[model samples]
Target: MARDADATKVRILAAATDEFAAHGFAGGRVERIAARAQSNVRMIYAYYGGKSGLFDATVAEALRRMAENVPPRPQDLAGWAGDVFDHHQRYPEVLRLSMWAQLERPEAGAEPREIYEDKALAVATVAARPLSPIDVLVFIYAIAQAWQLSPGGLTGLEEDPAGGDGVAARRQSVVVAVERMVHAQP
Candidate 1:
């Protein structure tokens, strides 16, 4: 039945997410994904065309999940930053996978770039009418990456240092600062 087929596809995708998260695309094996999904290799190819297609699907799905968690809000930069910071904490693997995709093939990141640009433009709409959506997107992502990496500051956002409350506060501060920079009145 169509329902059965859909269920199988979902299973494969879920399994693939985990496998790919643990291992980069070059390292991920189809057999491992099939086994984890409790399905067969044939099913994966049938539904996703091939490993490349599956990887693209997985990347798209991860971006979709992030978008769902952080909806577009022109005046909710703090909330959006928190959502994104938390998303990175909860699903760091997604970030790693995306990084891998970018390093492996820059073109592969185009679709996700478009998704992020559209979402960011919606949030930063109050900025100068001619704001480059790509710039806004890069700014948001750069902030998130800085917070996540925290070079000389916090290590991991989830693990609050002895006294530091959490990464949320630090992230909120950065978000507000960036908002001012992006939406500054001309």
Candidate 2:
């Protein structure tokens, strides 16, 4: 069978996403990505320039998926928080990849800034009380991600047939926190 360049690139990206998400930029290896992709290192370099480029592309793709999957709703920040929590639950890799990017490569292109600025502007426009748009946006995001970072448990997550409401309870807490923040904005 003949090789298809587009398919090869897709495979490379998917593999890179996994490798980079798990290992981060400094630790992520092009060879692992190539091996996972069932292709060669040369293809990765040719398609993405190098390891840095592949990491950038993988992060960009994760952010793109995140924005598309859980779009910000300035008017309904609480609902948006719930959606964000749900998105994180479904795609933890995306959040991990983002965290890795922020730690390893803090500098970002205008695309992320633009997205934040747009959301902040909308949040400011709809906010009941006078508030810092950036602060509000950041708070909402932090609240939504709280449960993902911690389940309010000392022994990890809890589970019981009697009153085990780990995921649901955590999700509800995230939504309620964002709601309270939105309501209490000043």
Candidate 3:
């Protein structure tokens, strides 16, 4: 009985995650989540307090899942980048919903942003030994932003002929050259 109840809550949470990841806080509907979960609306309120609380829980769960998959560390930078790229590729709606939450309710979304900041600082700390703080931040941010813009893993043929994999390869070469340039300097 207890196990069954727990399973139901987990199913509800999963349904809420998908719903929130698609519609965000302002657009998300409890009835839809309930229907998707095969549960009733009152179950959501009973389990999570209400829609806002569920949104917070859903966002926290989303970030928690991402953090678990990515784990913060300098050694895992490239792997983390790949994980993030794969996640966004598989679930662009999640990213879009996140962007919408940020735009619509900055205050309500503070926890997720704080989580991002903590992850960034952790990455910065690990990377700072070899690169300046600003440089590390820039490097991570650039890789993330560039990956988001390019779906084919950041170095593939694209809409712009001059900006295809060949160009990306060259750009990467230049970035490496610049990193070595800065590192080797007295």
Candidate 4:
């Protein structure tokens, strides 16, 4: 029974992830999620309370998966940046989901202070100097996501075809930028 319950929850969460990623919290439909998951609306409410609850859970799960899959490596910040960029490129829905959450439920997505504190501590442990880890992290993340968020603004790939190497060039630019940031003197 516990196994069945867990399986049901996984299915529901998977379905919810797709729905929320595609339609966001405001546009996502509980009925569509239920049908996709082969579960009923009551089960969704019982498991997740409501659409907001489900969205929160979905976002939380996505974050957890990201952390597990591509943890930060202060020793190799450039590699880590590339990995993060690759992950974002492959799973763009994660970014979309985050953007949707921020746009639709600004107040709800505020991560707990402890999460930030823990990350800061982790960064401090591996970082070379006393530079703020958060700053480094944010810069690397922004560089990695910039192309995806607004390719035309950064690389002009959207307007002109720089051949098939444009994406590779953009990715290399992110890696080089991260390398510079990591090596730069504070």
Give the TM-scores of the predictions, in the order they appear: 0.80, 0.86, 0.67, 0.87
Candidate 1 accuracy as lDDT: 0.73
- The regions of model 2 sitting more than 4 angstroms off are 108-111, 151-164
Candidate 2 local lDDT, 102-171, one digit each (tens): 8888875512666676777787778366558788788877877875665446426456412446667877
Q: What is the C-alpha RMSD of each candidate to the true structure, in Å?
A: 3.5, 2.9, 5.4, 2.7
Query: Each candidate: what lDDT?
Result: 0.73, 0.79, 0.65, 0.80
The clash numbers for all candidates, in the given order, read: 0, 0, 0, 0
Worst 10 residues of 4 by lDDT: 110-119
lDDT of 1 by residue, 1-186 (tens): 335887888899889888887787888999999998989999889999989889888878887877787676666664566567768878887787787677665676624666766786685565453456556556666776666555545354346643356555666776786667566665
Best by lDDT: 4
Q: Which stretches of candidate 4 lie over 4 Å from their true place?
A: 1-3, 110-116, 127-130, 151-164
Task: Provide the lDDT at 148 for model 1.
Answer: 52
Report lDDT (Cα) of residue 105, candidate 4: 85
Backbone clash total, candidate 1: 0
Ranking by lDDT: 4, 2, 1, 3
Top candidate on TM-score is 4
